[model samples]
Target: DVKVTQSSRYLVKRTGEKVFLECVQDMDHENMFWYRQDPGLGLRLIYFSYDVKMKEKGDIPEGYSVSREKKERFSLILESASTNQTSMYLCASSLYSGRRYEQYFGPGTRLTVT
Candidate 1:
């Protein structure tokens, strides 16, 4: 089974602190992504990595960065956590080439920046 594990199910931070969220996928998928889900807005991609050490910026990569030094591990770094950044962060994984390449999501991390 495709499994993605997130570092935290919930997180609380101050207005301007650096936060790091980690995700790991056991399926060895070539594509991994980080997204944030808000109330009105659907899931917006923060960043994605197609391969190890290769990354792509998604729609909202303004205050975030990512690292994919290992094939199974991807990390999302929030340069400065803010109240506006409080949202549900989801990590997903999918195969690079497949017929039905639907992303498998993690449980998600609910971050509250106070």
Candidate 2:
């Protein structure tokens, strides 16, 4: 089964504190992604990595970054957690077979910046 695991289910961070959220996929998918899900706004991509040690910025990469050091693991880093950054962060992964692959999502990490 394709499974994705997020590091935290919930987080309370102060404004300006660096935050890190980790994710891992057991299925050897080549594309891993970080996204923030908000009400009425839908899912917005934060970053993605296509391969180990390679990364790319996504739609909302501004205060956020990502790392993919190994095939099964991906990490999202928030330079400084802000009140506006508080939201549900989801991690997803998809295969690179050129076929239409649906992303498998994690349980999500709800962050509250105070």
Candidate 3:
């Protein structure tokens, strides 16, 4: 079975603070993603990395950045946290087959930016 783990289950940070959210996958999947879940907007993609040192901006990447230095690790960086950014952040991993790939998700990190 594939396993994905997030660095924190809950995080509280003040406005303008730099925050780091970490995710790790054991399956060595080729694609990794970061998303933010909100009540109305649902799941919105933040960033994704298809390979080591490669990154792409997702639907919402205005204030976030991502890093994939190693195959097993992916990190999401919030340059400046804001109250509007408070949400449940999810990390997912999947192998990119020709067809639709099944993504395995982590438990998520609930971020509260005050």
The parts of candidate 3 lying over 4 Å away from their true place are 98-100
C-alpha lDDT score of every prediction, in listed order:
0.95, 0.94, 0.95
Q: Which digits, one per residue and each the tens of the lDDT, describe model 3 over residues 1-114?
A: 899999999999999999999999999799999999999888999999999999999999999998899999999999999999999999999998766598999999999999
After aligning candidate 2 to the native by TM-score, how far in Å is the CA of 67 from where it should be?
Answer: 0.9
The number of residue pairs in model 2 that clash at the backbone is 0
1-114 per-residue lDDT for model 2 (tens digits): 889999999999999999999999999999999999999999999999989999989998999988888999999999988899999999999998879489999999999999
Across residues 66-86, which tens digit of lDDT does each residue of candidate 1 receive?
999999999999988889999
Candidate 2 collision pairs? none
User: Each candidate's TM vs. the true structure?
Assistant: 0.97, 0.96, 0.96
Give RMSD (Å) of candidate 3 vs. truth. Answer: 1.0
Better of 1 and 2 by lDDT: 1
TM-score for candidate 3, please give it. 0.96
